[model samples]
Target chain A: MMKILLLLISFPVFAQDFTGCGEYKFKGILKYDEKAPLKMSYLVREGTGSQMTFSLVNKSDVITLAPFIDKPSQFKAKIVKLMDGTKGELRTPMEIGLRFPDPMSASDTGIEKIKSVKCQ
Target chain B: MKATKPFVLPIFLLCLSFSVGHAAEGSKQFYFLGGGGEPEGETTIFDGEVKRVGSFINSSGWNSTVSFNGGHSKTEDLIKSKMGKAKNAGTFSEKNYNDLMNEIIQKLEKGELKSGDQLLISIDTHGAKRSAGKDAEKTHRVALAHSTATELNNLSGARTVDLDKLEKIINLAAEKNVKLGILDFSCYSGNLLNLHNDKVCLISASGPEQYSYATTAVSLGFFTFSYPITFGSKFFDNMKKGKSLEELFIDSRTTGDTPDFPMINTKEGLAINEMMYRFLTPYLNYNYSSTNNFSAGYVRRGDKFEEQVCRMESSHSDFLKLLKQMEEAAAVANESGREEFQNLREALEEYRKYQRGYEETLRQKFDVEKEIKDIFKKQFPNDQKAWEAYAPLDFLSLNLDSSITYYEGLAERDKGKKYFSGMWDSTVAQLKKQKEISEYVKANLSQNGLDKLKAQDEAFAKSGVTYKLSSRISAEAKKVYEALYNKNKSAESNPCRDFVL
Candidate 1:
């Protein structure tokens, strides 16, 4: 009964649309720990004409993404956490992946997933 | 017909003697005004200047006439009261402006005035470079008050006066024995110095390659406003004492720490005597608390940025070349050169740091340009021409920022021996000041009820700001970038060529 009350308290605090079910996987030039992997959640917000904004939160950095052109679902974000940062966008499907055109770095490719949650 | 021919000969001979006879008399002053800005929205600064100059000539009891192409009725009345009827027009069209100039030339050609009588011709307008034929150099033309670029394109019916036409007029005046003194208050006015002869004297606001700034803040050109301020009550008094126009030009100090180098070019062997006028005190009568230092600041910053970038590139190349030479010498030296070789290697390592910094600058430039273009595209999605119009200014902003960042890094790397940090600091400050003025001008345009597109078009059309950025700044950028490329090419082509071993 006490654990159920704790669950209710934490449920209301989760970011809007961030149900804590999403799992992001690293790929391409960027190396990561295979054992732990990467995880995150995103919330969509209103944007300027034909654009949609997404906020991605993680422990190290919080990235804000929006479409550069008319491709709304393929949201772009600038990664400032790397060597002086880079600009790129992510394409989300069954498993999401990252792409960028920066000449300095080739480490931007990645993937994402959302796992179903079970409650008893 | 025979009788008429003999009479014409006698009449010509008599007029020739009459023209020669008056060569020893005093000078005569005539005023000709061309284009000033809109009269309703702003104070008629040029017309006011005409009134003041007319008042001075009248107060000094000189025989002169003022004929302005367009002036307010009130200013025309003032001129009439002081001198005589000014050639007043409600709107100074190109046809009307050319007509006014023709009238003056005809009067001079017809011997309306005696020889040695000086005609002080002052023109206040915006000047532009008119591209010439493949074999010819580009010449400048001054836009008339109501003239538009559309009119400029219709060359057969263009309103502006080219240097060739102006030179022909000056030649005619000289042939008629009338001394011509020109006070051209416009950008690239110094090009008028080309007409200099024993019979002509010229003074301009800026060199041919430079810009003369105007600010809505002051509502008058800095050079134009400074004219009377520096001359004081001595304006007419000095002229009476026979101070050549060059002296007068030098005396009229530019106001408020102007970076523009106002120039005066006189004919060879002109009289160089210093004559004191009756009036010594100066009064900046129409003082504006705020001033427009935009053009001067912009030119200075652009120049400094180019110099800094070129210097950094040159120094890096020279250092590398020096390293290669030292290595070559060490290869031929005995064991005693070991210590020197160690020192040379250390120096080479230090120079490599600078080389990497310069390389980083190139990369940063690419990044900044990409970011700026993205921002501009996002802002003006539909207008490609606006993108072109604004691209130079945006490019300059990022170029300057990159330069500042590089300089900061260099200063930190060199410890106490910061080579170019001082100049970079001042350049950055000037850039900031110009950005503020640009924003203010942009805001003013919007408030004046011009929609964004219309504002961009009209501002570029009327203000001469189009020429200010696109050509001049881009040319400077190209110069620096080319210098860097050349340095890299030379370094790569002859890598260690001097290392004999």
Candidate 2:
């Protein structure tokens, strides 16, 4: 009886479920060297939607997106370069892929929402 | 032979039973490893102003100084005495440190320490970019610091361990089936919680980019001392009798000068103790509270309001009515008669601006949400779902900066959604009149307004929806109205405007 009571009382305090469900979209600047194999960026997405896309834009210059279409989600061409003339793509590890790709896209429309990009 | 056999069998059975029971119960182990040492002879400047400094200097001693007298004789004496004590203290030499760590690993592998057991490893050392060079090499452990998630799992030994040894060690004590909490007072301690786990609860003194300091006046660092002080003796006395981890952490942040100490836990909503929540809620209830301290409070208040006002579908017709009023006001301004027409036009323009501001606010919020999502994706490649539920509203409310007045209109139409309707509705109404919303957006978005607007446009295109407004307007009107409404709504919801109250 004592053991059961203790368990009951301690239940709410200890019980917790940490699982990521639903959908979310997030965004942040790529923090790593653009030329590096992997670039670090932050992103946020919310709601239940069939597609999500991430894009990067430089405050100043415009670069072409033709050379950077390999994995747009992982890496993308900067429309413009910083005043210093350093050119790089926003990229992270490609192994992870789109975290929550729309299941329907694969089965129905065959459209991949995430892609890679490079600047000419 | 018969007599001997009977006794031996009974003993064997009893021994087997004991071993099995022990195995079933699992192991309980807690590990803490952290220290900071700068071998290049660091300087400690003692100001003559504070007594606390005097005590610290006296207790720990300065570079070569023994006492405040600045006498060379005493300095040499103190150094010699301390050196002798240090040698005798048996701090980890290379051989010993490895041996101790290996022994812990061996125990874990042997299942001597089972799952649901506690393991706390704390490091109070300088973080280095690399595990080489002077200060970096002596204070750093390349294997411990750079160990991958797989490596941690291999050494953990138990079927259900409390701590997940991913890129960072997550404290599993607050979660179900485990009772453990780890405190790493180092600069990047918050990174530990970045690992994907809803079960674990983490409290970091500072974010990864920031540094954590321990003042001379306090025996422990700000976070370290605050935990014990706020939670009181109960934490130590029974562990179970103390406030929940969430409560203790909330109190610590609220009471200190800490910035928005990001708390990521799996437990849905504010899992803090009721008493603590009640206590902290009032401090945040005031309109003029500082943004740094009260942002978390607003989040909590918003969450509370959400609970009261259960999710409403598109059926609440009052939302349409309010939108119609605004639309009518716009139309009247477009085609009016006389002298007060200018005043009316200005008000309509203000209202239109408010709408645009609201949309912009949503777009900005989405940007923040996207940034957070990207951060999580980078951090937890394997467990994206853990970050998904972490803050549902952070993403849910991204494009949902609707006027409180609008929400109230919905509440009035549907009584069921009026749980704490009055509170939030009134606050929103006040904000609408005060131009707080517009000011907040201008202040925060001054640096990145254009980029944010473009992102909003892109978000709309990608989502296949041009505007987030009442479904009453035509698709084209909704798009235009959304842009206008967001601008004005942001003006009304500005924190500074609300703070004026």
Candidate 3:
């Protein structure tokens, strides 16, 4: 089971949300929604996601995704509402993307990050 | 719909007999996914409705899938803020939600789903009215949380899950013979009736055209902790103990102050849904707390449904009364603090008005003194006699300025002397009393409502608006007093006082 750590940063007006990285073999990309704006996606060898899947852990605690995430990655790096302080919001339509620094490991990081691997 | 068939009646047609029980070989998978996508909505829900999604979040019986849109996190930070870290929390975004649905679909296709497998996807998010497909029940659109990662898809608009798209995933599950139940807690959630089928049973917070509500008191939407039910039956609490989701919904619908929005009384919870009561809610032994109150629901609850399940036949009558006492004590303390804050605000405003008048009158007096001096000089160039006569008039003018009163007798001499010099020694006294009482209530209150009330009080303290305003007033009042002292001292020696007019 791969555990992905979420490192947080807060928006000026909103609560803090963390970003995490893990190492995964760059499996090939797949189609999620052909019609929606962000349709192309990729897969992590260890995950069960049809397109791609990952799980998040915050600080030292592993909460909420208790069932699905305790095993191999089977969930997406979940998105949160990022507000447009000027307007009302800015939306990130569902799309799967992955990247990692060189030498990513199962200790400091999780698996080989499905990094910079373009969809065929 | 799966190739193999079973002799079971459709779910909507009165659930037939109690065909579902613990005997099922398959596991009951429950996913409590969602919170308002927006930060405002997230804060409103994460504390109440979303937190209660713990029916199986921590349980070993049913497999729980937990995801949240907002908190200090994707997981409910309210728990993290009070307790410590939580377990296996996931994030909520349109992409993630779709992925989850797809995962389920994949599971069913792989024959991973068994005949007895039951899947309950409980959702709570903000909603908006939108035009959906022809076959769609209504235009209820869920405002799904967007990923904060501005990397891939940065569309500048509201984020909504395509109901039509979500419906496709649900229908596929149904076709695969998966028993899919949807419990939607969003405004106009009933539009999910579009998902209605033999394998699916849908429950919503309100009808397609209606709006849902939440309360600071309950920290929940009206549906969960609504007034129509006796003291509001918590849906998940009942689900925790063996009550079915359908039963909990019926209990809330029939008993809520429905057909109308819940009117919150600091003393008593007001009313609930009408059309809902006549239809599916059947009847629970409960009564009205007020008129025009039957059309609403809450995201929170006063009593656990299981506690009342045993109490239904025997001790249901005292349920509201008991809840009322608990609510009243809590309500009064919090309400009093807020009420006093408002009262103090008004009092300060009134005081400022007087201050403006006092300053204006002083300015006018100064003008009069200059005008008199000018007139005397213009009439008699260097005439010392004329200047002396004008001095007595200047003294009288200064007296008049001191005597000026904007609010009847509440003049500067009395006013400045009153709040600043004496009387009303404690500014915002009522607010102070309420705050003190709130501190006491927060310290001594029982476990049931204390945390929430304390949170509110803590938030109030953190805002510090009241104290900030009071301190500003105190500083401004001191300025007024200093001006009055100088005016009085100057009045004592008017230079022409001895030259009586």
DockQ of each candidate relative to the true complex: 0.01, 0.04, 0.01
For residues B211-303, could you state the per-residue lDDT of candidate 1 as single tens digits? 443322122345323133222212332443334554455444222122222334342111110110001000000111211122111111222
Predicted candidate 3 versus true structure: per-residue lDDT over B377-470, tens digit per residue: 5543554321232222212212222122211232233455543322212212322332343244334434533343344335323332332333
Residues A1-120, candidate 1: write the lDDT tens digits: 011000000000001122223333322222111121121223221110111122232322211111111111222223222111112222232111222211111111122233433321
What TM-score against the true fold does each predicted structure earn?
A: 0.39, 0.27, 0.35
Q: Where does the lowest 10-residue lDDT sum fall in candidate 2 chain B?
A: B152-161
- What candidate 1 gets wrong by more than 4 Å, as runs, is A1-120, B1-27, B39-42, B60-63, B69-91, B130-139, B147-159, B213-243, B253-256, B267-308, B311-363, B367-501
State residue B393's C-alpha deviation in candidate 2, in Å: 41
Point out the higher-scoring one by TM-score: 1 or 2. Answer: 1
CAPRI tier of model 3: incorrect
**Model 1 DockQ class:** incorrect
Which stretches in model 3 have alpha-carbon errors above 4 Å?
A: A1-120, B1-24, B40-42, B71-75, B79-89, B132-139, B146-157, B217-233, B258-501
lDDT of 1 at B138: 33
Local distance difference test scores for all models: 0.37, 0.29, 0.36
Please give, for residues B1-501, the per-residue lDDT of candidate 2 as tens digits.
Answer: 446665898899999999997687433333323222211121111111112222322343221111111113332233334333222212223343355445545545554544555343333332211111222221112112111112111111111111224223232232223433444343333444445344444444433322333322122334312122211111121122223444444334322222112232323212321112222212211111111211112122222434422321121223334445555675776733222323323433333343344344454654554554564565446644323333422222222234343445544754554533443344344434323323333344434644665665454333312112111122222133223323233322221111110
- Chain B: TM-scores of all predictions: 0.45, 0.29, 0.41
